[model samples]
Target: MGFFQLLMKKKELIPLVMFMTVAASGASSFAVYSLWKSDVIIDRKGNPEPWENVDPTVPQKLITINQQWKPIEELQQVRRATR
Candidate 1:
C-alpha cells in the first residue's frame, strides 16, 4: 500500500530518483584506482592490485643546538636595587 502510494503521483520522477540514488551510492566509496578514468560512475581498472600493506614513514623532529645564543634566550636577569 505505501509503495503504491509512492508510485502514484510522480511516476515520471521515479526513474530519475532511481538513477540519482544509484549514482549517489556508486559514488560513495567508488575509487577510480590507479591509472584509470572517472565519471558519473568510475570506470574501474582491474589491472594493478592495490597496495596491500602501507609502510608509513614517520618523521622525527630534527633539532640543532648551536654553541652561541642569538640574543633572545641569552638575555641576562635584570637586578632592581632597593633604596
Candidate 2:
C-alpha cells in the first residue's frame, strides 16, 4: 500500500500525526525567529541607539596598574599581596 493508504488504514493515529507535524513546524518557526532576532542588537530601552548617542571617549578602568610592565615574579607578588 502507498503512504496515503497506510495513513488511511491507521485512522486512529491521524490526529496525533497532524498535531506532531503542526507542533514541529511551530517550533521550527520559533527557532528561526530566535536566530533572526539574535542578528539585531538593542539598547537599554529596547530601542536601537543612534550613532550620535554612542560615546567615542575611552572609559576609565576599575583596576589601574601603576607600573606599565613588570616581571612575572613581581606581578605574582602583587597579586598575592592583594589577596
TM-score of each: 0.31, 0.44
For each candidate, the alpha-carbon lDDT, in order, equals 0.46, 0.63
RMSD in Å for all candidates: 20.7, 15.6
Please list the residue runs of candidate 1 whose C-alpha ends up more than 4 Å from where it truly belongs after superposition: 1-7, 31-83
Please give me the total number of clashing residue pairs in predicted model 2. Answer: 0
Which candidate should be chosen as best, given TM-score against the real structure? 2
Model 1: how far residue 24 lies from native, Å: 0.2
Candidate 2 displacement at residue 5 in angstroms: 0.7
Worst ten in a row by lDDT for model 1: 52-61
lDDT of 1 at 23: 94
> What C-alpha root-mean-square deviation, in Å, does candidate 2 show against the real structure?
15.6
Off by over 4 Å in 2: 39-83
- Cα lDDT of model 2 by residue, 5-79, tens digit: 888999988888899999999999977665534234555476554432433343223355563543478866986
